[model samples]
Target: MPYSPEDKKRAVMRLRRIKGQAAALERAVEEGTDCKSLLQQIAALRGAANGLMAEVLDSHLRELFGSAKETVAVREARDPDEEIEALMKTLRTYLK
Candidate 1:
């Protein structure tokens, strides 16, 4: 399912923050920031990206399998257990 307006807004805000983090990292590099500080910035950027990915993944899963309001016919078209298992496998491989 597509993101609701609120979700889209939140995602845009997150992406903007990530863009800011990237810009900061670029500036740090140009200014020859210390390795420790650079590493910390990189880590923070990575965490933010991962967090955004996780939030979107959660939203997708909820739309696919957790919505109590979904029609019976819609629910019958997919196997939630199988979908979840596939998603888990993908996540495991991605995280590794």
Candidate 2:
């Protein structure tokens, strides 16, 4: 489930920030910045990327199942084991 134009714009803005942070990290390395400080920045960038991924996943789940609580209802109607297996397959395919 791709976002609307407005949502895409917002996500792009976040990605731009992450890009800038990455550039800063590069500059810091060239300038001999402390390893600990660079590591912290890298960790923060990873967190930001994870947050963006979470948003994407949440959006996809909502599009598929309507909402967070509604997902439980959908899952309940389906066989739990089968659903888990199907989800794993889907994840594997998506990752590839």
Candidate 3:
């Protein structure tokens, strides 16, 4: 999906938080932190990863389903001469 700048920023922030959580988890593991503490960290990290995955999957699905409308709008807005030229270019490419 082509995300807006704000959406991209939010996604980056989410991933950054997830990365921090992962780093903390790694530290806990190396230091032999209590099992319960490790488990909690694992759960939190998994949740964050799942949330990000869901968001990205949703965006991908939206792009797949929504692009038809976007394509139509673009085609409708194009100048006739431009459209003809585009079509000619496509034909030339296909023929080659």
Candidate 4:
């Protein structure tokens, strides 16, 4: 269930699109776009970011659980706090 080359390419493309949206957001602010319009753009960017995150999580889940025996072991060893900490660290840069 590992990601294929096509998956990598698609992820890269999505990232590039997100980068462009970020640049557009900057430009909108600089050009004094209406607050509502700016907020809408921001929302769209957030959705895109969330979609990327979902894709990554789905891929990880597939890698960890697609095999029947491994899936059971993973569930038995689940650690919610540890998982949350890992996610927090991974996402901290975005907060800054």
Candidate 5:
């Protein structure tokens, strides 16, 4: 399902924050900031990215399984449990 207006707004806000973080990181590098501070900024950026990914992924999974228009044959052809397991594994790897 497509994002609701509020969801879109929130996602856009998050993306803007990520962009700001990226800009700050770039500025820090150009300014020759300390290694520890740069590493912290990098970690913060990664965490923000991961949070956004998880939010979108959750919405996608909900839409895939919760749609009323999904055909019986289509649903039967794909196992929700298996799909979820695979998604979980992928997420775990990505988070790491």
Candidate 6:
């Protein structure tokens, strides 16, 4: 589903933060920062990215099946099994 302007703004903010974190991570590795500090930054970045993913997934599910209404024609065109399996694969890859 396409995001509303507000949602798009929020997601963009998240992505920017993640980008900054990634750059910092690269610098840390290149400069051979202390192991503990590097691990902490890495963990924090991973958690932030995961949270963003969770929000996107939740929003999409809600739009498709929860409070928000989707077009019946569009909904009917999709196979439930295929959709479920696709979501499962995406979740697996995201979590992995």
lDDT (tens digit, per residue) of candidate 3 on 62-90: 65445555777765675767655755674
TM-score, model 1 to reference:
0.81
lDDT of 1 by residue, 27-54 (tens): 9999999999999999999999997888
Separately for all candidates shown, the number of backbone clashes (residues 3 or more apart, or on different chains) is 0, 0, 0, 0, 0, 0
Enumerate residue pairs that collide in model 2.
Answer: none
Which residue ranges in model 6 land beyond 4 Å of their true spot? Answer: 68-86
Clashing pairs in 4: none
Model 4 lDDT tens row, 48-91: 89888777767865554455656566676877677667666756
lDDT of each residue in 1-96, candidate 2, tens digit only: 457887687778878988988999899999999999999989988887877776676666555555555656676786667655766786677566
Per-residue lDDT of model 6, residues 1-96, tens digit only: 337888888888888999999999999999999999999999989988987887799877766453536668877877889778877887788677
lDDT comparison, 1 vs 3, better candidate: 1
TM-score of 2: 0.67
Better of 3 and 4 by TM-score: 4
Pairs of residues at least 3 apart in sequence or in different chains that clash in candidate 5:
none
Best by TM-score: 1
TM-scores for all candidates: the values are 0.81, 0.67, 0.66, 0.68, 0.72, 0.73
User: lDDT (CA) for every model shown?
Assistant: 0.87, 0.75, 0.75, 0.79, 0.85, 0.82
Error of 6 at 65 (Å): 0.4
TM-score, cand. 6 vs. native: 0.73
Give Cα distance to truth, residue 33, candidate 2, Å. Answer: 0.7
lDDT of 2 at 44: 84
